[model samples]
Target: MPSTEAPTTHDLQATARRVRRDIIRMTAAAQSGHPAGSLSCTDLLVAVYFGGILRHDPANPFWPERDRFVFSKGHATPAYYAVLAEAGYFPTDELLTFRTLGSRLQGHTVMGNPPGVEMSAGALGMGLSFSLGLALAARMDRAPHRVYCMLSDGDCNEGQTWEAAMASAHHRVDNLTAIVDYNHIQNDGFSDYTRYSGDGDRDRVGGWVLDSGYTVKGAHPGAGRGGPQGAGRLMVRAKGLDSSLRSE
Candidate 1:
């Protein structure tokens, strides 16, 4: 098992590099996979898994008290798989088998087969809703687990995401938190900013829910595609959110 101690900055640096390398190698071996988003989210995930922001056990993936993470931006399995492997959830060698016919590491995550995957993510915009359900369920059962969902700018554009966000607020679901990989680039090309702002209201925060009383927006103007700089900035913001939420 990997050490339970929180990794030092140097440790996180090395692990992030290795995870990025794994993402590249895995996608190259498969000859077809999404690497950009995977690369973009490397530091965010590294912080979550290695920075002591998540409660989990590779040996007991189904531990009742383990925190649940849903990769709403499911197509970015390259990052997810690499993080899982480096965290000791699975052997790193299996990363090269990604997207292969018999590999458990498919283009998108499938829950049961993969040791750490918490959701069967493929369709966009549904992860937050699922996470809300999990968080609500834990509240009902008085469970101590927290639910996290990682989304993309594309996922946020979906109507289901809005509804789920609204519902989460209405129900006072404090155990759930979501992070968006708003890298601006989707499968096709750059995302439409108008769509994100909902009818040209660029300042509007998706009109999620005013009653929730919790909102965070971190915008790094030129960091979106600036390699490590972009990833690092986003990672820092995400790490802060995860840390603050954990305290609550």
Candidate 2:
């Protein structure tokens, strides 16, 4: 079971460090994987799993009452696997076999292969919709568990993402929350061609997100506040890596 009490800041930091190390080692062993994305989202995962933001029992991953965490940024499985392993969902040693021909830890997440994974995702835009479905199912079942979807800025550019966002709002899916890893980089290069904001550290990107009618709340995962509350809201955080391409 997850810790009933919140983890101390030092504990969270140490866990984040170990998770990041695992991400690097796993990707290095695989010889091909998206380490950057994994690294970027490490803190978020750490906060959720170790900081007690997510209610899950690694011993019984399929527990019907556990909150669902959907990694919409599918390629970031290195972090996903590492976090689950750290949380005791599976043996940490299995992480080295990631991307191997027969390993359950594939390049992207596949449900049922690993114990904690709630969704099988590879395409960019589909995770939000899938999470929405889960949220809706829980609602229909009158289940109390919440659904969380972690996305990348690239996913926001997808039309389906917007569609799902609007639908989530329209349906009043308050049990679902979307978090975007606003790293500003994507598979095709930077997510947007726009220039950096006046602050220089941030970019003036994802204008379409506001146009999509979703309020984006900035969050710092290390704070352990458990992300934004309520549904139909997108949480944007600058905790991701600036580059998407993994340097060999």
User: Per-residue CA lDDT of candidate 1, range 73-189, in tens?
Assistant: 889999999999888888988889999988898899898658789989878889988988998899889997777677877787789987887776667676665666656677779
Residue 219 Cα positional deviation in candidate 2, in Å, after optimal superposition? 9.3
Query: lDDT (0-100) at residue 82 of candidate 1?
Result: 91
Question: How well is each residue in 104-130 modelled by candidate 2, as lDDT tens digits?
Answer: 999988987698888888888889999
Error of 1 at 97 (Å): 0.7
Cα error, residue 159 of model 1, in Å, equals: 1.0
The number of the candidate with the highest lDDT is 2
Regions of model 1 farther than 4 Å from truth: 1-3, 192-248
lDDT of each: 0.69, 0.71
Q: What is the lDDT of residue 170 in candidate 1?
A: 68
Q: Lowest-scoring 10 consecutive residues by lDDT in candidate 2?
A: 208-217
After TM-score superposition, what is the CA distance of residue 32 in candidate 1 from its true location, in Å?
A: 0.4
